[model samples]
Target: MKHIIERAQIYQALKAGIKKTGVVLPGDVKRALHQAIEKETGPAGKVLRFIAENLESAERENMPMCQDTGMVVAFVEMGDKVEIKDAFIDDIIHDAIADAYEEGYFRKSVVEDPLNGRKNTGNNLPAVIHHELKKGSDLKISLMLKGFGSENCSRLAMFKPTAGRDEVIESIAKIVVEAGGSPCPPTILGIGIGGTMDYAAKLSKKALIRELDDSHPDPYYAQLEDDILKRVNELGIGGGGLGGDITTLAVKVEKFPTHIAGLPVAVTVNCWADRKTIVELKGKDN
Candidate 1:
């Protein structure tokens, strides 16, 4: 017996998911913003109030929350027992992205070429896709619309194994300071430790999707998150980078095993919007 899924169904789901993500702030992020507004004063508080209002309006109107619709980053977990009928997985994703950007009026920000004759792709095609294989007959997809304001502020550092935890903390603090008002403060920090350079970077991006209300299961990392969040807020970046406490809403860390000689740390910055949505499809054996 085979558990099968249709390509059209997958495409429609992807299309809807991307569109929704662009317009809606995740519950965790929205709640954090409301809390920040209550805790803030002066201009920072005003900014948070405006941001909250914007988010509400965007969802109500079914419109993009931001001018920069951002590049789509997707993480797909596929089950070995189920197959996508009559289409390649990635092609399906690209098609869905293109249609979503067009029909949803999302800004097409991707470039066809990295250098020289750089031209707009016209549609947000060729999403950055990450795939993983998992047990059971289920397809889980998560999408992130990552705007350049935060992406540009992200940093990666490769440290010697002896650099120690203090060094790691210092590095993260340095990033927040340097980023200043640029990444649109009251941002979330996604810190990825260990692993190779690229893997570390990927982990950092993946960390952004973690729920803001949750802490690292490991007590060590959970403590680190608290410490880092405190240090970052001390920067006085505040909401919209106008200056105050609450530069960072949360700090999330994800780590992978790496070689004995290296400790690679990557930080992915996400603006207060933190747009993301996830979809899951289950298949039953016939």
Candidate 2:
């Protein structure tokens, strides 16, 4: 039986996602921040305290956690057995974003053109959407609001297949070191390895949505993540780059198959806000 989803459900989901993610830091993120605060000292500790206070205020006041509401990126998983009733998914999502941004008074950061004109899109329409068809009868939507401050600091590199693990580690660590506090320290690092250039980049962005508390299922990758995280924190960049122990809140890595001769890696940095929201919808009982 085909599961039918209503247009209203999609609209509500998009709007709620924006509101939820924009204002409140995720539970895991908050916990990490608190842990950082306890472990930090000196100016970095003070800076972290201020960040925590600001986040609490934002959540209490129901205001955006950051002034730059960011570019919308939606990942949608649609079940093959489901059909929407009288609604186009993309259209509905964009319209909901327009309404939510307007109603919630969120910043419209998307530009109509990237290079030349640089005109603002005004309503933050045309979200970058990624869709996948799955086997079930439910739909899952994950939204990420990416601020350019961190996005601009992202890096991608293509290594020869024969490059050793040390090469990969040093390469990515160098990116974090050079970035300093620019991408906003206490940032979450998303590392993507073993895909084509573009896919590596995509995987890096996708990795950002994963919770900080979750560990990679594979022990090798888990150890790699831990090693990289330790190296980054040891850089002594500290909170907000003033210098200290907690430069990165967490490091998440995702990998994919690549050409035998090419190993591509991408690093995406996400600031302390790390806004991610998810919604799942199921068909009504027949």
Kindly report which residue stretches of model 2 are placed more than 4 angstroms away from their true locations once superposed.
none
Error of 1 at 93 (Å): 1.2
- Residue 31 of model 1 has an lDDT of 88
Task: Report lDDT (Cα) of residue 212, candidate 1.
Answer: 96
Give lDDT tens digits, candidate 2, residues 1-286.
8888898988898798888888989999999999999998757998899999999899899888889898988889999888898788999889988988888889999988889999998998779898889998899988888988888889999999999888998998899888888987888999999878988988898888898999999999999999999998888988889999999999999999999999999999888889988889997644
How many residue pairs clash in each candidate at the backbone level? 0, 1
What alpha-carbon RMSD in Å does predicted model 2 have with respect to the real structure?
A: 1.1
For model 2, the local distance difference test gives 0.89
| CA lDDT of every candidate | 0.89, 0.89
Query: Each model's TM-score, in the order given?
Result: 0.97, 0.97
Worst 10 residues of 1 by lDDT: 277-286
